[model samples]
Target: MTPEPQAASTRADPAILSIADAIAHPVKAANFPQTILRFRNDRHAATIGLDALDDKRWCHHFGRFNPMPGNLPQPLALAYHGHQFRNYNPQIGDGRGFLFAQFRDDKGRLLDLGTKGSGQTPFSRDGDGRLTLKGAVREILATEMLETLGVHTSKTFSVIETGESLWRGDEPSPTRSAVLVRLSHSHIRFGTFQRIAFEDDAAKMHRVVRYALETLYDQQNGENDAAALLNLAVERMADLAASYMVAGFVHGVLNTDNMNITGESFDYGPWRFAPTWDPGFTAAYFDHGGLYAFARQPEAIHWNLGQLAVALRLISDAPPLIAALERFGPLYQQALVRRFCWRLGVVPQGMETDRALVGAAEALMMQGGLGIDAFFFAWMGDATPECPADQQGTEGEALWSAFGAVKAGYAPARVRTHAYWQGDAPQSMLIGEVEDIWAAIAERDDWGPLSAKVDAVRTMGEALRG
Candidate 1:
């Protein structure tokens, strides 16, 4: 969804157009071959209101549709690289992705909005640069749902589907192709620094660091010179990891290039919420080794930040950067504890009992293969009481015994629905019920049910306020 900006309009102005024009190099950064014509707009998207057929697209990605436009990097688009999957591949930049231009709001702050899957730049190398249409659709749902779930993620500006098929042998068959327009604060990945660091180019690495600090961490500019920006970046990375872990999220690919200094989450791929609290959940299809597992996401983020520190250390004094990085563990732990407490409807304090409560919740999830979304969304109204006989047992007992217990807070009429019996209860649960509600609204995009669900969740959490 296009976020509610501070009175920002979807349309472009002369200045914006000029920025687009200035950065219209099609094959500059890592020039690759082949640019196909697959121009379509995200039809089912809500950000650009479908009411105005003229406004039914993200013009930022494509000035107009169906044209293979050259993307010369914005005069300011700088180059860098990083490690992918822990293996240092120095030779990488925006090989496939490119920055569109910096979107300036009325306040005059620059938002480095950009696009991915806009086919083949000089960096395309051996792979196809174009994104499949299904991939585009998947991103639309994934990004939007994530936004609703309050995860830091890149917003899907547009998803234009193309009917053509693209091959990915990993799956059952070839997938249809399409392009996606992604809106992000910035697309500079951890790989950018890794590339320069790997190349032993201390100057370029430092330049990119200085550029990012000035660009993203402008708040630090007023403080003591370069040291402030470096410290700010380190702090932000820790903050990002902390937020992510408490949200039950695993990015599944915490590669160095995927890390952002600005600290907002971007680069969505095979990401997922933990279904079980094992911390071993791996959402990426390629992560057979579980390198970016749910339990390891926090560690992986810090490690990536460490790599960034190493790269920056090449240009600056290592001690301050090291000190900044050293604070990551405590920063992440504190943030995670506080956020998780909030998620569980509790006010956080450094209480041992409260920590045990959190552990108990995780232990329960580990015992039940509950879909994380379904679990929380359905748990919105009420939870069934545990059986008296099994009061002292584990979470599995609670899961099993609660099947016949009464649930409070909802209408007495909803008691039957909350009873988790195999023979009774709604044949279809909340997702299905929500789907039905959505169908009615899709007649005219009525948002009542979704809004109601949100309200109900708040009410339930408040009532059970710990």
Candidate 2:
């Protein structure tokens, strides 16, 4: 069952406490040298009734880690094990962050306030618990862009610049430091189950499964078994993979720890949007094998789900888990067609025609080297299709035919009425633009470009939403 509607004044529910304490360790937040507020997502805050907080109180709650009313008395550094790049690691958990609080949105959906770069915990091993200010900014941009593109992503609720200088090999030494708070559906990860399974605790695993089904997921048919939970997870992740593909996003690292049970995309690390439809496009520089590249995301997610299934075998039989895992392929294909049609601003035909349309779009992008943004911007809402003159042959012909078939089935669903649509190009958050935004802040302490970019991105989202 879903959590009861939280009282207006008692919003911080802390549902995770119902689980075993062994899964989470009580921890204190780091005392930062400074607490300068960088960003607060008022729009998302309003959903959970945090929009009314003044900057001072907001900083106290987020930056200083003060407990909210009726919330957890102390923060919890959640414990779990994960497979990093397919190498199983038993010694990993929340090293720098913790679950701050839990609450229900205005719509009664349970949500969590999880932190990043907040402090060190028992899990911190040979590393200082800190986050680069540049890293927080990138997460802000990534979540904003992904949410606008119709991906189910976590909202970057707060970013506070903590007065500290952090060293990292990937970035310039002694870069600025900060903390990030993410608003997400749940922080429970696939690795959470792996941790329990590692210890062979079947009863505790069952308790976690029940907590997930009752609190996190909605059941239409009243199923409440481990297999049912696995099925729902599989379906949600399949849709997520499809959304990432349609949005041209590369999550960079699709580790089992990063794959949350709720299927919402969070934990932005070296994320990037592909400039084009290159299957081999990789976001993280460390991804030499391109394991989580643009084209391999679906397979990676499927593999992670297999790990989840393996863990679920502690409480479920192999046959049911296998059946659940098999659903990912068809579900992903369906989601791809649905999201692709939605992004194109067109009414979709039946599955066969929709798949043909998607196939043609992929072929066109690969053959012509067209950027994803340019292709989507040119084709929104039944606008005139632009085909390059050089390759008006087979690929172009297939694309135009697909467009006609789709348009003939039903009229375009989106209109260019919003002022954002009046712009010549779509808003894109490519790596070059991200670096430029960071340079403004790093060099001159200028936040004008970042603010302007966020506003433009939001406006573009509004235009797309309409």
Candidate 3:
């Protein structure tokens, strides 16, 4: 076996503690009956200097929720209120999770280690705090796939199967339970500000805004004011929405609480990849209104940003925040052109040509009912030689016309030489495939398939990054 990284450290820098105390509450972890190390993301762990931990130590810290040296003295469940499905709910917060620790990577970027399904807290009004093992597995798969697609997503760092059975209406009775740990830039959500605003605490709002500007947006040099933070969030969120579109992902839940101030995607629940170019595809069964549908994601993000703007009014006037909100449409349009071109493996021609090309491609996809993955996979770099027989037809001609206009002056951005490019089919994580992978683990405890899938995803990431 390869040796672990030698520079791994045991101490952590709990930066969230620097903020006000009203937003955090001390909580104790559930006493799990057993701790079986199921999955560990050593690649990401190495970045935070935690890869050297053995399974025993990993469980002690992640499973048992022990504090690392210099980390938070105890686990703290965060407080935040949000609009769940457009209904203002001030009673919600860290119901099943807490901020466990924080660390700085080798590049000096602050990263947070947070838990999910660790246990119940003051916010657990009428629910158990356990997580289904299957849920944990799905989150692992989702993060891996999103990361490979070049989306700014949280990393699923560790999962440990707790010796407990969870009962839920959605799944079969007494499903296996697990605890998950995710690595993200910040756990402070859009609702975090809303919570303080609801309390009419202007001082806390300013303090938290300054804290976010310093810890999360530190790279955004100069003018660390509320308006500047809102502008930065607008750009990041617009790009995030575009990345999800190009990746064919539906986050299922777009509540303000699920959206962090950093604009990174996390808290995956009932997320799905579109099987084809269906605009109204919905991921969650409970989304009866399809408010967060596949095609409406941009709208949902914009609406969430407006809520953030409303919260930020506690510190800044409406003019600047409204101005920041107005930029979303233009930013999203530009982001779509840029990200769509990147996925197509072509350098973007100017804005007008790129926009036309994207429009044509979308029209072709909808007209032909083409699979999202297949369309991008076949047309990457516009090589066409490897294009599937079914994807080439009269409808594609118009798309090709627009594509040619965009490609007239630019060469392909990536070569189709990677081994993954030679495969007969592209890597996809449709619900069927995800179920098959989970079925293996549920029936026979066979982890080979999951391991292989992660390896394939990382390899695909390498090819894309090249």
Cα lDDT, all candidates: 0.53, 0.90, 0.88
Clashes of 2: 0
Candidate 3 displacement at residue 338 in angstroms: 1.2
* Residues 1-466 of candidate 3: C-alpha lDDT, one tens digit per residue: 3343346543367889888396899999999999999999999988878888888888989999877767788999999999999999999999999999999887778899999999999998997888999999999999999999989999999999999988999988789999999999999999999999999998898788888888888844455377988998999999999999999999999999999899999999899999887789999999999999999999999999999999888878899899999999999999998988888888888889888777767875777556788778777874654223554666665555555555555568988999988998888899999999999999999999999999998988887877
- lDDT per residue for candidate 2 within 1-466, as digits (tens), equals 2233333633667889999486899999999999999999999988888887889888988999988878899999999999999999999999999999999888778999999999899999987989999999999999999999999999999999999999999999789999999999999999999999999999999888888988898553344388998999999999999999999999999999999999999999999999999999999999999999999999999999999999999988899899999999999999999999899888888789889788777866776657898888877885766556754775666666565555556568898788877778889989999999999999999999999998988888888889
Q: Which predicted model would earn the best lDDT?
A: 2
Clash totals for all candidate models: 27, 0, 0
lDDT for model 2: 0.90
Compared to the true structure, candidate 3 yields what TM-score? Answer: 0.95
User: How large an RMSD does model 3 have?
Assistant: 2.7
lDDT of 3: 0.88
Estimated TM-score for each candidate:
0.70, 0.95, 0.95
Which residue runs does candidate 3 get wrong by more than 4 Å? 1-11, 219-224, 386-410
Question: Which 10-residue span in candidate 1 carries the lowest summed lDDT?
Answer: 421-430
Q: Which model, 1 or 3, shows the larger TM-score?
A: 3
lDDT of 1 by residue, 1-466 (tens): 5432322233321232332222233443222232233333232222322213333333423432321122223422334566678987755555546665455433444455455665566556776766654455445544554554445667766554444457776643466555556665666666666666666776555455556665555553343333555566667777677666656677777888777767768776666666446578887889999999888887888888888777666667777777878888777766666555554433455645445545555555566454444433333333444333533465566653343222221222122232222222211112244444535443554546544544444333333332
